[model samples]
Target: MVTKSDTNSVQVEIVPSRFLMPETAQRLLCEIYKNGGIRRIMIHGPNMPREVPYGPGKGIPIEANRNLLVEIGDQAIELRVKVGRIRLEMESEDYLGGLKAACERALPFSFQFRQGKFFHDRMTTSDYAKYGKVEDERILGLIDPKAKKDKLAILSEDMVTFKEDEER
Candidate 1:
């Protein structure tokens, strides 16, 4: 029974995380390493999914936890950021890569939902209405972290259990 108005009062923030350039897949990092190093960089982290055009999307949404929402997608998940840093090898792959890797190693992020001052995720405040409220169950069966490694799956489960558990 959550209403759009309920969300109007909420704000969400995407906690920023680092990306290990090589961690994604070896293929993408070859050029970066061969060139020695990259100069200057910009990075972006993933955010709560706002409403998109009414076309079918790949997966459902998941709120970070019960009550307050910190939205994240599983299928067709967006990398929270648009830009990022380049790793230079000082000692070992895991070193430069690991520094970023360990920090980046959070793999998927964790969320905390609060009642007041919804996190904005640096989103355009004016377009806030387009972003609808979401629930945690939306993420259950969404991602197969092992198979895709990169993509997460929806947390699919029985609707009755989901709703019932959501309240607790």
Candidate 2:
């Protein structure tokens, strides 16, 4: 179980000047994942609907053909949003410099990086009603309670990709 002390982890947010495409988002995410101190990550942006939501064309499939999959250390993450901003918690402030560098390498345009309390430190009523006293605090606000599909994906630093890179 996560305690109050553990919830005090350093939180950082990265907001790009514009909404990122899947390819750019994928590159940025892979770099962030490579740096390896991310305890939790949340991406925010406008949702891309799979079908028309209103009008006579409602319920019909949209013609938008976009690759929503991004590979990070052998893990393929599905992109549900346009990736305008990214909020994450780190183990410590020591990793901030490397994170900034990673963002610079991936993002060609300007971006903003700030530090503050962005995530919930404690569980909410909805969370309790849905998950019933979750033991893992890292994912407290990572997903929606009503959503049927689980959006949370866990990636380890000890994955084969990382191990292979270390051997070189």
CA-lDDT, candidates in order:
0.28, 0.74
Please provide TM-scores, in order, for all candidate models, with all chains considered together: 0.18, 0.81
lDDT of 2 at 121: 64
lDDT of 2 by residue, 1-168 (tens): 844564446889999998998889989999998898877777788877768889999988754624567787776655666789999888788889999999999999999999987877689898787778766565566655555434454323344222111100
Error of 1 at 159 (Å): 11
Candidate with the greatest lDDT versus the true structure: 2
Model 2: residue 8 alpha-carbon error in angstroms: 7.2
Candidate 2 stretches greater than 4 Å from native: 1-8, 145-168
Model 1: worst 10 consecutive residues (lDDT sum): 159-168
